[model samples]
Target: MPEAAPAPGAPPHPVAGQEPGGPRVLLPHLRGFAGRLIAVMVLSLVTVVGALAQPLVIRMVVDALADSEPIKGLVAALVALVLGVAAVNAVRDFWLQRVAEGAVRAVRTRLTAHLLRLPVAEYDLRRSGDLLSRVSADTTLLRNVLTTGVFDLVTGAVTVLGAAVVMALLDPLLLAAAGLGLGLGMLCSLIAARWIRPLSERAQARLGEMTSEVERAVSAARTIRAAGAEERESRAIADRARLAYEAGVRVARVRAAVSPLSMLGTQGAFLLVLGVGGARVASGAIGVGDLIAFVLYVFYLVSPLTQAVNAYVQVQTGLGAASRIGEILAIPAEDLHGRGPAPDRAVRTPANGAAAEGADGAPAAVEFDAVSFDYGAGPVLDEVSFTAPHGGVTAIVGPSGAGKSTLLALVERFYDPRSGTIRADGVDVTELSRSQLRSKLAYVEQEAPVLAGTIRDNLLLATPDATREELLAVLDTVNLRGLAERTSKGLDAEVGDAGVRLSGGERQRLALARALLTDAPILLLDEPTSQLDANNEAALRDAIAAVSRQRTLLVVAHRLSTVADADQILVLDSGRVVGQGRHHDLARENAAYHELAARQLLVT
Candidate 1:
C-alpha cells in the first residue's frame, strides 16, 4: 500500500495525552501565542483607559455647566473624547480578531498532524464519526475560546479593576456596596463552575456519539437501502442526536440561570450605590458631579463582572475539547526503529548469498518455527511448523478455516507472529526491516484489490519506476496487453473505485502483472486463479510457471489441478500441516487430500 503524503506546515512535536491537570495543557498553547496575546492585551488596556476616561470627562462637563464656564471649551473636550475612544476601540478590535484567527490556525494544524500519526491499530477500534467530531466540532469550539473568550477575559478584568479603584477613591461607603455584590457574584460563578466541567464533558461526548451515528448511516447507505432499513437507521441516528441535544440543553439551563443571577448581583450593587451616594450628595459631603462619576464607574464595573462569568464558562468548554483531542493523540503510533536490518540492505538472492537453514540448522528451507497468532481473539495458528525449499513450488492446500491466509500474513509481516518465528533464507523475518522483507516478496491476495486509477497506475504500484517497455512486457506476460489496448485511453483509462469497471479475471490479471513487474525473488500467491475460467486459469498457470523458474514460490491452492504439478504439497487441516509430499503422493496417502481431490472441490 502507498503511504500518504505528510501535510504542509504541520507541527514537528508529538501531542499525546492531556497534561497532569487541565490548567497545564492550556498553558502551553496559550504561551505559544503569548506574543500576539500580549499585543491584544495592550490594545485592550488602551480601550479600557479610553472607556474609563469618559466618566471623568462627563464629570468635567457637568462641573463646567454648574459653574457656568465657557460652553465652547467644554463642547470641544467632549467631541475629542468621543473620537479618541472610537479610534482606540477600532484598532483594538482589528488586532484582536487577527490574533484569534492566527492562534486557531496554529492549533488546528498541530491537532491534525498528531491525529495522522496515530497507529493503524487505534483506528481499528475507533469510530470515524467520533474522530471527525474532534477534528471539526471540537476545534470550532476552541476557536470561539481563542477569539471571543480571550477578548472578554482581558477586557473584563481591566474594566472591573479600574472601576473598583476609582470607586474607592470617590466614596469608601459606595465602594463597600460594589464589593459586596461582586463577592456574591463570584460565589455564584464558582458554584456554576462545579457543574460546568462535568456537563461540558458529557455534552462533547454525546456530540461525538451523534456524529458517529450519522457517519455510519452515510458509509452504509447502500446496505441500508438494500435491506430497507432507512427508517430504522434514521431512528437510531435520531436517538443519538436527541441524547446530544438533551446534554446541550442541560448545559444551556445552567448557563441561562447563571447569567441572570450574575446580572441580579450587579443590579443590587447599583441600587445600594445609588441610595448611599444620593444621601451623601444630599448631606453635601461630596459634590453631585463626583457622585455622578462614581455611579457611571459602577456600571462600567458590572460589564466586566458579567463577562468574567461568561469567560469561565468558555474555559470549561475548551477544556472538554482539549481532553477529546488528547485521547486520540495518546494512542501509541507504530514504532519505526528497532534492531532489524536497515531498509537499504541489498536483496539476498540464493545464487549470490549464504546457504539457507531450517529451524534445526539442517540447510532445509523456509520454516515456520512454532508460529502462533491471534486477531484479538484466541490463537489462530498454534505451534504450526513447515518448510518449502527453493527451485520448486510448495503448495499449501487446506479447508476454509485452516489459517491459510493467516500464515501468509505472518510471512509478509502485515502482522508479527505472537510466538516463535518465521525464517526466510535462513534469517528470522522478524530480524529484517519491514520494507526490506516486503521488497523481496511478491504478494497476490485472494481479492486482488485494484485502486481507483488508471490500469498503468495499478501495474506500477509495485515498481513505480518501471519503463514503458517493461510495463508492456509484464502486461503481455499476463495476457492483459490486449485488454489494455482495447480501452479508449488504453493504459490511462480510469479503473473506477476498487476497479469496479473491470471484470474479475481482468482484476486478477492486473494483480498478476503488478506482481510480475516487481521481479521479486519470493512469490506468495493466494488462490491467484480463483476468479478465472478454465482458459484464463490455464493462461495464469502458464504465467506463474514462467515466473517461478527464477524465484521461490509458495502457492496457496484450493484446486488440485493448480497444485498437482507442484514439486511438493503440504496438506493443512485445522491450522496444522497434516500431510507433506508430492501432489499425487499426498492424494494417495492422505485421507483428507484424497477426499478433497475426489470431491473436485479445488478452486481450479
Candidate 2:
C-alpha cells in the first residue's frame, strides 16, 4: 500500500525556467565547492604562467646565441623554469583531483539520501534500476566534468591567452594568422560536441535500462527459472546492452573526429605562421630571433587550442549524464524527511471523525473514516470505514485484493487516502510526520521481508538498543527460540539475500520477532501464518494470542479459524467492510463471513 511511484516511463518532474529535459541545475552544488576551486585556481595560475613563460625564455636564449651573449645563463634559466612548472603542476593536480572527487562524493551522498527519503509513492513510480544508475553512473559524470574537463579547460584557456599576448607583442600579422586557425578549430569542436551531446544522453539512458533489466531478472531469478525463461531474459538484457553499446559507439564516432578536426586547424595555423613570418624575416621587418619566438608562441597556442576543443567535448558528454541526475533531484520528496514530535505514547480518543472510544480507558489506536483511495488509476478502496480500538486484536478477512492489505497500509500512513481521514489516538495521522507515526507501530508485511544479515542484525533493525536478554525474549515470543539455537551462529547466523538462506517459516518468524522487538504500542501483521505448516501455525496462533494481550493488534488474517476469538472481525469483499462483530457471530450471520469460513473449513 505504499503510494504508487510515478509511472516507469513518465517524464521527470519539470523544473522552472527550463525545457522538459535539463541539466544545468548543478549550480547549487558547484556554489558549495567554490572555495575549494579557488584554491585550485591559484595553483593552476602559477603552473600555467610558468608554462607560458617558457617560450619567452627560449626567445631570450635564441637572441643571446645570435648576439653571442652567454647562452649558458639563458639555458640555466630555462631549466629552472621547467622545474618550477613541473612542481606547480604536480601540486595543482593533487588538490584539483581531490576537490573534484570530494565534490562528486558530496553530490552522490546527498542525492542518495534524498532518494531513500522520498515518499513511498515516488518510489512506486520510479524504477530501482534508474535510481541505481543515477547513484552510480550519473554522479560519475560530475567527477569527469569537475576534474578532467575543468583541468583541461583551465590550463588550455590560460595557455592560449598567454600565447596570444606574446605572439601579438612579437608580430601582429602572425597573431592574426594563428587566430584564424584557432577559430576554425573552435567551430569544428562545437559541431562535434553538439552531435555527441545527444548521443551521450541516449547512451546513459540505455545504461540505466540495462541496469534495470539486470536487477529485475536477478530479483526474480527463481520465478524466471521456474517459468523456464532464462533464454528470454538473456535476450532481453542483451538487447538493452546492445542498445547501450550502439549509443556509445555513436558518441565515440562524433568524439573521434573532434581531436583530428582540432588538430587540422592547429596545423593550418602553423603553416600560415611559417609562411607569413618567414616573408617578414626576409624583408627585414623582424629579427630572426623574434620570428622564431613568434613561431614558438604559435606552437604553444596550438596545443592549448586543441586541448580546449577536447575538453569542450568532454563537457558536452558530462552534461548529457548530468541531465539525468538533475531529473532525479527535481522529483519532490514528500516530506518524509521532516521532523515531528514523537508519537504520543498515551493514545487519545479519536477526534475529527475518528473512531469514538469505547468504555475502556485505552485510546483508539487506528480509525478509518470513509477512507477512499487508489493506486493511481482507479479506486481500490471506496468509502471503506472501520475502527480498531486502542488495545486488543482486530482481524481483517477478505478475498484476494479485497483491499485488506490496503486498509492496513492506510492505517500505517504509507499513502494518505485520496478521500477521508485516518486518525491515530484522535489526532489526524496526516498531521504527524511519517517518521513520528511509524515510530509508534511495529509492522510485519505480508511477505515478511528479511534483509541479508545475521539474525541479530535483522532483529536489531527494529530495536537497535535492545539488549541480548531482551532480544532472546522477543525471539521466544515468535516461537524462534529453537531457530536461534539450531543455527551455527545462533542470533548471529546469516540470513541470505531476502532471507533465502532461512526456511520460509523461519523468515516469517524472524520478521515477527523483529517486529516484537520494536515494543511499539500498535502491531500490524499481514497474513502472519500464511507460510507456516500446521505445527508452526498452531504455535504462532498461541504466540499471536499471547502478544495481543499487551498491545493493540490489527492483523490481516487469511485463515478464518485463527481469528475466531478476535475482539473484532471485519469481513471485507470488493473494498467495503461487509460485517463487523465477534468471529463466531459473523460466522453465524454474515453471508460473506460464512462463505469464507466454509471455504477455509473454519467453524466459529
- In model 2, the Cα lDDT at residue 94 comes to 86
Tell me the TM-score of model 2. Answer: 0.92
| Candidate 2 lDDT by residue in tens digits, 469-499 | 9988888877788777886788898888989
Q: Lowest summed-lDDT stretch of 10 residues in model 2?
A: 341-350
lDDT of each: 0.75, 0.80
**lDDT per residue, candidate 1, 395-513, as tens digits?**
88888877787777668765565566677777777677766777778999888888899989998988999988888888898778887788688889888777878888889889878
The prediction achieving the highest lDDT against the true structure is 2
* Residue 342 displacement in candidate 2 (angstroms): 21
Best by TM-score: 2
TM-scores for the candidates: 0.78, 0.92
Instruction: Give stretches of model 2 more than 4 Å off.
Output: 1-12, 15-35, 337-355
